[model samples]
Target: MKLFFAFAIIAIALSVVYGAPADPWNEYKTKHGKKFGSTAEDAQRKKLFLAKDALIAKHNSQPKASYQLEHNEFSDMTPAELSQYLGAVKPANKTRSLESMVRLEMETRQLPDSLDYRTDSCLPGVRNQKQCGSCWAFAAITPLEFARCKKHGALRAISEQQLVDCEPYDYGCGGGWYTNAWYYLQYEAGGAAKRSLYPYTATDNTCAFSSSMIGAKISSYGDLPSFDAAYMQSVLQDYGPISVAIAVTDSFFSYASGVYTDVECDDPNAYVNHAVVVVGWGTDNGIDYWIVRNSWGTKWGSAGYILMERGVNKCKIEKYPATILSVV
Candidate 1:
């Protein structure tokens, strides 16, 4: 009995020390999972991640994970290239993970064949949905904003928060897709609450009318091609960056800094992550990379983005592409 009591005390102490481990990732799941899947089951994958050293020992040959900056673009790029491409690096720039990956993106000129995964309304604050678990709305609606700009020759930030608050016709905050969001906005007569009108609070709430609210008449592209590398590249080359979803890497959790290539060792199962935006692609130092935007806020990653390898292109946006737009 005494031994059991001691073990119980140790367990309680560890819990307090580590803080509540109630899947601290739950908050992460709700926000990022929106576009990845309707249910958390799709967005998250289970994996037993061993420590870096342990992983090396298990793999025996050393997985060749580049955690340090021996070849990162920021460290390797010349001053002229840095000035033209990256400008001057600040102290904070030293720690960004996607820095090396973006070098490949900057050189790419490939454009998609047509507009896709974009909307007429180009809104900001993808991070706001983290609380609401409304990532799909952000993912689905963003393409609309960019597409409309290209189609109409105009530029403006739309509102994802408005979608969160105004579209009571859908699943509220639990989660919904961009296709459904487009339908919701279209049915609401093309007037969606703008960011100022209905900002993202991350909580499920009632949709109240606001005067300043403005949004595009949500439209569809018939049926978008499956979300894949070929499709994503084609869209970017022709239209622009396509808002997309994919399996996020769990090492994305340990990603304090450094460019992420396939060489970066991580749990594959944990990589089934969801995200929005496919900026562009290119090659640097003879390696291919994909430029991607993220909603985790600029402070969290490569200025709220990441560089994925072109060959590593995986994941399929479940639904067809949709977009956000300006109502007036």
Candidate 2:
């Protein structure tokens, strides 16, 4: 019994000195279906996983934290590796000046205290963008899908790969702006192809666009003014979903739940690096937030969604709101 107790004490001391046991790492790997090419690779991944897990625990322990983090598919990835997921890039020159774009008139009536398009069945299931930086394509396609549902009474999965391949103004998976994608659909491609016909490859491929597979076409697209959450809500209610950009930080990669409000991402002029869809808005415990949809798959966030603090243009979310005006 004495010997057993001494061994146990040594084990505890070892854990305290080195870190926790490998049980959590093993379980995380299994949960995420993570596989490594070799033992060395596995060890490196485990180290990264442990470091991320510690950061998550530390952040969650803070009593005043507005959000939480957890081990998900990105848990084993390094910060540099995780950044590959962000693909939204700002255009060097606007296709049209922000002032020239049609803005939604502010609604005079009272907006709903809470709104969610997912409950309305207008939006489709969450999609995974994988390792490719094709978030701009995904973001651009979702609002079009929503508009189709609103206008035609049928929700259709349009091909994001079409934009990734055909849009000459934007750099396929390297990164892109949704407005440029819209311009391609409007003037160049004429229309978007159905997902069933032209599926997403998550890679830059030669344009294989066939006009015969056209599923949906937009008549016109417009941008909403920045720092106008009320107008954004009005547009969402009158129209459908709006494609917007946000400033993604290191903390954003591990976001699990709660209203995401980070000081680092609060700058109005902060570079918006990722594109997402704003499906709706609501107040949670007195804090207003936008129900933003992400393309990183259901394993991340609240089944591939994040509640961004609204009204304050949190993470530059309200900076560049663009949407299709009418579906054809």
Candidate 3:
């Protein structure tokens, strides 16, 4: 018994050093209601548990950080695996410059010191993207919804299903650009249908769009100057929400709450794999952040939203924001 105790103490010390705690099998199972089916399943579950424990430790190691991490459906996933689930695939061709697309006389306004569109009743409810890489579709359509709501005084959930299925310019569930989705909405589909009319299935299906069922129409879309938060703030105040692509990494996937600022994800040349809407911006504990609405369900972040680090363009969020012109 003395020898066993010594070994257990050593094990705990080693775990502390390595940042991976002993798997709390019972505790995890209790929290998630998860059960392993077989010996192989049990091994997989154990692996995931270790990964989760390591991530928890990593999160706790950061001192004075604004955010905290939580265990969720993605706890089991590696950064690569999480990338598969996000799927905001950008097009291979270079995107066109915003200067050529915007009308010369579009009205504009400046934001207050801080702004949150959701507070003004601009945004709708949180959405879940599921396993599809259709975050581009969700990010693209949400601003359209905001634009329509601002013009017509009624918030409507535009169909991402239409963009996911019908737009040939994009890769559908495999991946696509949010800007291409805007072009598709303006010219191809003539506008998107209501989500109630064509609910999301998280899979690519046949195009069921009809011109007669159009709920919102966008005349044009333009990009914010790359890496300009000041311009983005003005656009958000004058227009509505904007679509943005980000360099999603392991840290981003594990994010739960507070302002996220990761140097690894700050690489502008890093592949932009996930897309979301920039609905607002604010500061928390002197850490400036952009209030972004994610489509990973309300369980993922702070009610399906993330407070991303602002000013420095963490995760390259400031690089690819696009505004839409809605004709409600």
- In terms of TM-score, the best-performing candidate is 2
Which segments of model 3 are wrong by more than 4 Å? 1-23, 33-36, 78-80, 94-100, 103-111
Q: Where is model 1 more than 4 Å wrong at Cα?
A: 1-63, 66-128, 151-154, 168-170, 210-212, 256-273, 315-328
The numbered model that scores best in lDDT is 2
| Model 3 lDDT per residue over 136-221, tens place | 98998888888888888888888999988998877778888888888777766777888888889999999888887788888777
Clashes of each: 31, 0, 0
Rank candidates by TM-score, best first.
Answer: 2, 3, 1
Give lDDT tens digits, candidate 1, residues 1-328. 9999999999999989997666523443454442334444433322221233244234333355433211111222233322221111111232221121111122345554333222224434335344345666666556666666666666546667666666654454555445455555665536455555556666666666564566454443322344345644654655555655554433443333334553333334423234366666656555555665665555545555565556454333322232232233
All candidates: CA RMSD (Å): 15.9, 3.8, 5.3
The CA lDDT of each predicted structure is 0.46, 0.88, 0.80
Estimate the overall C-alpha local distance difference test score of candidate 3. 0.80
lDDT of 2: 0.88
| Tens-digit lDDT track of model 2 for 141-260 | 999998888899988999999998889877888889898888888777899999999999889999899999999998888898888888889889888889998899878989999999
**Residue 290: error of model 2 in Å?**
0.5
